[model samples]
Each structure stands twice: as structure tokens, then as C-alpha cells.
Target: MTDEKNMNHNNEEIIEKAKKFFREIIAENHVKNTEKLENIKEFKVNPFTHKYLANFLTGNDDPKSLAKALIYPRVLGTSITTSFGQNLQTFVNTTLEGYGSTTTGMDIEFIDKLDGRKKYCQIKAGPQTINKDDVTTIRNHFRDVINLGRTNGIPIANMDCVVGVFYGTYNDLSAFYKNLAEDYTVLAGKDFWYHLTGDEDFYNKLTDAIGEIANEFDGTELLEKTINQLAMQLQQVDGIDE
Candidate 1:
């Protein structure tokens, strides 16, 4: 029992040392990129290391900060993980092995090769469509899985785990994308002529009205008539209810 205790203590010391090393490396990287050091937190090199790192990089470390960052495409649009579908299976295998997890629910679906490059594999979640709720659940699950792996001394790298997290996020958000498409279609259907109103006559009249307004105050009547006509035309074309 004493021996076991000593071994466990030693293992913990090793983990602490590893964590410090990782923290320094990450700090250096952030510094190189002109990111403020205060913006970076100390690194924890556990199974969930990548998840934490990804979260930090993506500005998801705090709920409020994440909400603000979500408005613009920062990490989501500008990370290696965004293009992870290009090599799905390899990423999955690497991440799973890194985390030392018994491959649970691991199935690969083939997506078309992009630009004649890598053949993509989409990691399937289950036999059902993914939704927004599923996305939150899966992301949490991934964090748990990765942290478990790290605690076990699995020797998994951050890169391996990050790839998996990216793929998982992508799969989970698929439904959201579908919903967006449907919503766009509905909106477009409601305002069909909003996009189709760019006729030569419309452009000419608009230009003439603008010139008249700029050139003469006496053009107010003409401007009002032109504006009313344009509004009527747009309302008619868009099928708007009177």
C-alpha cells in the first residue's frame, strides 16, 4: 500500500511538471501571435487539455465572453479544426487513441473528397439527426472524455484531441445548418421581390430622383411621386399584403 501511494504521488508530480511545460509552450505561442499574456490561462495537460485549449482559443472559456465572441467568426472560422472534415477517420483514430478511450459509438461516413485532396470521413454520433441541444451535449461529452483520458496518463497530444472536438462540433451543428437553410427559404419566399427588384427602369428613376433632390428644392413634388411609385412597385412585386 505504501509503495502504491508513493507511485501515485510520483505520477502526480510528473503530471504537474507536464502541465507546467505545456503552459509555457502555449504562452510562447500566444505571445508570438501578439496575444496578451493575461488573456491566456495556465495550461492543464490532462485528457481534456485540448478541449480547454480550444475553448480558450475560441473565446468560450466564459459564457458571457463566448456569447460576445460568437457574434463574429473567430475561432470557428479560423481554426485548423474547421477544415477537419477533410480527414475525419484519421483524426478520430488519433484523438481516441490519444485519450485512450474504448472507441464508443465510432462510425465513419464518407464525404466527397475536396479539391481532389483528402477523402473526408464524418464521425457519426448516432442513427438520428443532430440538433442544437445535441451540439451542447456532445461538446460537453467530448470535454469529459478527453479529461478522463488525460487523468489516466494516456500520452495523448492536444492536436489529436482538438481534431476530434472539431469534428464532433461540426456534426452536432449539422442540424442547425439545415434549420438555417429552411428559415432562409421561408424568409425569401415571403420577400421574393426584395432580391429581384434591380431593374434598369428602377435604377434610372432612382438616379433621376437623387439628382433632382440634390439639384433643386422645387423637385420635392417629383421626388415624393417617384418615392411613392417605387414603394408601390416594390410592394406589388414582393406580394406584400396592402
Candidate 2:
């Protein structure tokens, strides 16, 4: 009975640590995103533009969205920099890291131990992005890793590469990758999520959590402020100076 209690206590402690670390990661990214929004140059109401004000007055969903829509540069810049696909990868990486796994670098290398053997994973957004160049790079990287292992007398079979993708299938990949895909353990979509969490619904829960975090930074308040400022510019157009 005492041993079972101790095991439960350990599990609880691990759960708490995971929650704290995950929250901190989200909070840190939120701060950075807020800073980016704040640093964008103040929105100026162009006198010649008539649609912007109208959109602000009666836009789809709410005035807040219209106000946000008017900041064309900010919208485009954030989309380009923090793309949805990239954000999804960030969610996956941070979640894994919170669970005490080591996530590293561009391709999101997740190093883990499986059946007393080391497994090296590379996660990609989709197979569509996997071109000949990517295959060559992966091949060379594994070659170097194998050579290093052999030099140290550690047997490494192709570096035990595993590729996990958020989307896309073998059909989506080009011909070269299709053939090479057989050499690696390729996990797609739910299979990838299942491999990570042992639950196929894990990705659904992750996406829901991501959506909630996204709502917090939708820039609603900032949009309202911009609309108010633009209203002041509208007054100027009406020959009223404030």
C-alpha cells in the first residue's frame, strides 16, 4: 500500500511539473507576440481610402475584426512569420518538451529511448515540403551520424531515423521521397499523435488548446483602439480637428 501511494505521488508531481512548464511556454510566446503587435507602426487613416472606415463600421463578425483587418501590414507580417503550420509545430514541440523530452533545432528533433535503443525523430508539417533536397539532407545527416557511431564502435543502423508529419501521406510526396520513405518509419497525422501520446484524440485536444490560446491574442482590444484612432482621422476628413 505504501509503495502504491508513493508511485501515485510521483505521477502527480510529474503532472504538475508538466502543466507549469507548458503554461510558461505559452505565456512567454504570448508576451513576444504582444510585443510584435505593439512595435508595429501606428495605423494611419488614409484620406483617400473609403472602404476601410466602412469596413470598420460594418464588417464581418464584429468591428474588432474589421479594425484588425485594416492593419494590412501587421496581418500579413504575422501570418508570414508565425504561420499556422509553424504554430502547430510549436505546439507539438512545446508539449513534448514539457513532458521532459528534449526537442531541438529546425526539423524538431525529438530524441527518445525506445526498448533500450535511441530513437531520433524529425517532424515536418507535411510531406509536400519533402523534396529531393530534403531527402539528400536527411541522407547525408544519417550518413555522418552512422560514421560517427562506427568511429566510436557504436553500431548505428542509419541512425534509426523516424519521420513524423502533421499532414500529407506517401501519395503526397514526390517520387524520390516515395521510394526513400520505405527506409524510414514515417508516421502521419493520427499515427504521429498516437506515437507521441498513445492516444489518437491527443491531436484534437492539442488543436483545441491552441485555439484557446489563439483567442487570447486575437488583438480585439488593439483593434478597438485602432478604430478609435481612425475615427479621429475621419473627423479630420470632415473638417473637424481634434
Which prediction has the highest lDDT against the true structure?
A: 2
Please report the candidate that would top TM-score against the real structure: 2
Stretches > 4 Å off in candidate 1: 1-101, 104-122, 125-128, 155-242
Question: How do the predictions measure up, each by TM-score?
Answer: 0.20, 0.52
What would the per-residue lDDT of candidate 2 be over residues 1-242, giving only the tens digit for each residue? 99547644543443443344445564455444443443223444453543555465466424334344555444446433355445555555444443332423224443332323455566666666577787777766656666766888977674265667765555665565565666766666656655554445655655455445554456566545655564444434433111
Q: What would the per-residue lDDT of candidate 1 be over residues 1-242, giving only the tens digit for each residue?
A: 99547644543443343334323442233223222111222112233343354376565544333222322232224322223333344433442222233433323212111122111112332223346775455444445545655798754322222111221222343454344333221112112111112121322333343334333224244333433443333334322121
Return the number of clashes found in candidate 1: 4
Off by over 4 Å in 2: 1-68, 72-94, 98-117, 125-135, 152-155, 166-182, 212-219, 227-242
Clashing pairs in 1: 47-146, 47-150, 48-146, 48-147
